[model samples]
Target: MSLRIFEQRYTRMVKEACGSESGFVICMLNSQGNKDLNEHIYPIGTYVNVVDFNLLDDGLLGVTVEGVRCVRITNIKTEADGLRIGDCEMTAPWEFTATKELLYPMDKKLEEIFKRYPEVNSLYETTNFDDPIWVINRWLELLPVDAEKKQEFLQENDCSKIVQYLSGLVE
Candidate 1:
């Protein structure tokens, strides 16, 4: 599976396009060109959507944005890019940790997950990876998806929506 990196603002479009039922939201570092070398650069602090993500495993989202790449991951408590959740209309020099799951994709991991969290469906009912439903479902698990939550996702701007959805899950 090709990793599809996107802005948190585009959650609605990504969800609509991928039809994912759940997953964590990510912000890519816009590292296409060196716009300002003097500025502090961290891999996960980027608010602008542009960065390359390292998808080390197959069937996992390894996509990253193009320019000045950084990720405002929602799982951490750092105040990178204003508040972690809400409309992303501000800028900042901040930091947050990437989720262990985002760093690790599962095939074998699925077996471990099934063994551990039997209550949760880590794998879907269908194995059709290409199907939009299946594809989105995988994304949903990765990004944290739910109906009422996704509706909130559909109504917000990209950046804050990711933070909101992720923050909601942690809460």
Candidate 2:
């Protein structure tokens, strides 16, 4: 459970990635309902591996994906059918280290969230509450902030800023 970016062939892309045991990068749309998808999508994305996939009750595919790392997208091309393809370069995962005491509130709040909403809980096959990086990553995904603001975080080499940012919200 990491980022989920919507696309024209969203389900198809998931299936292709899952069937082939390949990973995919997810980026955000700059604006909604834009016909020019390649131009509209932001450059930063999260590279994730498909953890699980199943045929949903609605007959659509249900997929569980976990973020492996970050990436920067370039040279995007949209096919006639509207599938946007791009060249991606690996970006460093935000780096930070903190003691369990510092991350306790975030970990506990996330635990409460999972307990309160089974649907959200069901998304992850496993959770690492004791790991600060794991907690920080989940907070980034769950935050309701604007995508533009969240995008600013990708540029930060020190993830301690993220830890501070999230602590302010969680506390």
lDDT of each: 0.37, 0.78
Best by TM-score: 2
Per-prediction TM-score: 0.19, 0.78
Provide the lDDT at 137 for model 2.
79
TM-score of 2: 0.78
lDDT string for model 2 (1-171, tens) is 532434448766777787898888878777753546465777789888888767666665667787788889989887666677789999877666556788868899999998999997887778888777788878888889778767787767767777878889999
Best by lDDT: 2
Model 1, 18-55: lDDT tens digits are 44422333442344424243122222332333233454
